[model samples]
Target: MKILIGNRNYSSWSLRPWLVLRHFEIPFEDEVLMLSGSGWREALQRRSPTGKVPVLIDGELAVAETIAIIEYLAEKFPDRAIWPRDQGDRALARSAAAEMHAGFSTLRSRAPMNLRASHPGKVDLDAVAGDLHRVETLWGSLLEKSGGPYLFGAFSAADAMFAPVATRLRTYELPVSDRVAGYVEAIYALPAFQDWLAKALQEPWVVDDDEIDVIQGRVAPGTLA
Candidate 1:
């Protein structure tokens, strides 16, 4: 198996399936293409037919989109337990993952992932308040229901799907309930995520366009941890 991904620092979509493969200790080769300069588009085309990063190439199967890649993994490796075992739990998990994939555009656009940078203050929440509230409610309910250190009692696709949101929370210092904040912290503590963060910190490349979200226009406050 092989996955094509973008730079670790700014590509939230790339992080999703990459984290899953790492978390599960799945044997896969990964290639990282920097999402900078004028050649990125041509580079992506050469990697995946969809012309996107995070495309999993397994034998003849090529999966695009984070959710699709994960689902493909689930079917191919049924014993790995990629989704919850219980029917009801599995359905709920899928719903949450789908919501994360299709919605949350406001938060996504306003706060791009910058793993090497930290912003400790809120710029403002009004712009993203509705999405923020829904996330809090969804996370709070899931945590309470599953007694979670993860969203569905164990680390599954749902957690992977929302992993980027945790990064967004830290990047923007966006307000969230203590429970949700703890969820973010828990995801951060995962060995897979930590490994990704270490590499991101070491990366010399940077995309100037991605840093525009830093409201104060200040330097990196500290390591994203």
Candidate 2:
């Protein structure tokens, strides 16, 4: 399979399926498109019906959207254990992934994912408190049940769906409990995640749009250079 993605540095949507593919050692080709600038839309349109990044193109089928791509992969590689084996865990995992997929707009808008931006302290988190609580409650219960380094006992699609949230929490330095912070650390420490982060640090592109606080002169640029 070939996955067309935006830059590893800024595209959280692109990161999901890419991480899953890499984590499971599924051999796949990837093409990165600049998330900004002229012609990028045309480039995306060519590969995906929805004209979105993170489109997975198999032999004859094309999958758009992160969740759809993940579901497709799960079906294609059933033995890979992309989701949990236990029916209850599988249902909960799907629900968690779905929640991450469709909900959390408040947090998403206030804390845009910027791999190269530094927000040293909390900002606009109050506006997103409800959403934050939802995340924490969902995660806390799951972790308590699974006794996990991941949301589930294993790193499933739910983790992949929420991977960008971990980066957002880190980038903004949001005040989370020790449990949530530990979860973030575990996600960051994953070899797949670290590989993505290293590439993000080295990439030349800086998404001016995602640099929310920096553009507003609220926080300084967090670029490595």
Candidate 3:
């Protein structure tokens, strides 16, 4: 099995499957495709039918989309326990991941994933604020129901689904209360998250389009530096 991913720093979609595989201890070869300039576009077109990162290729089968890839992995490695065991918890987890997959366009657009960059207390968009509020509510409710640490107690597909959002909230310093802060801390403390960030910090490829300048705790209109 082989997994094709994008840049470690900016490709949130790529992080999903990568984290899932790592969390479950699934042995797979990783192929990192740096998404800089037209190279990413051409590479993705050739590598995946959907031209997206996080494609899982198992011999002849090529899987695209983060959720699909995760579901496939869960089925393929049932012993790894990727999803919740309880039926009710599994339903909620799937719903949470699906909601994350479908919604949060505003937040995603304004704060694209750049795991290595930290912009302290710099939230300025109302749409993004609303999305963050929803996320906090979701996280708090899940923590309350599951009892500490991950959203579903043990790491599930849900955690892999929301890991990028956690990184976004932390990097941008978005408004989060104690509960949300604790949850984010747990996510950052995960071994997989630590591994991914360490690899990302070592990479030298930087995209100018992804970087933003800040003034007085707000992103200023400037090209990537």
lDDT of all predictions: 0.86, 0.86, 0.86
User: Candidate 2 residues 79-109, lDDT tens each?
Assistant: 9999998999999999999888899998887
lDDT of 3: 0.86
Task: Kindly report the root-mean-square deviation of model 1 from the true structure over all alpha carbons.
Answer: 3.4
Candidate 3 local lDDT, 1-225, one digit each (tens): 999998899889999889999988999989888677666788778988888788999989999999999999999998887999999999999999999999988878777788779976555667687898899889899999999799999988899999989888888988888998888899899999899999998887776555644333235534344
Regions of model 2 farther than 4 Å from truth: 214-225
Candidate 1 lDDT tens digits, 1-225 = 999898999889999888889998899998898787679888878878888888999989888989889998988888888899999999999999999999999888777788888866544578889899999999999999999999988898899889999998988788888999999999999999999899988988777657744334554623222
Clashes of each: 0, 0, 0
Tell me model 1's lDDT, rounded to 2 decimals.
Answer: 0.86
TM-score of 2: 0.93
TM-score of each: 0.92, 0.93, 0.92
Point out the worst 10-residue segment of candidate 2 by lDDT.
216-225
Candidate 3 wrong stretches, greater than 4 Å: 214-225
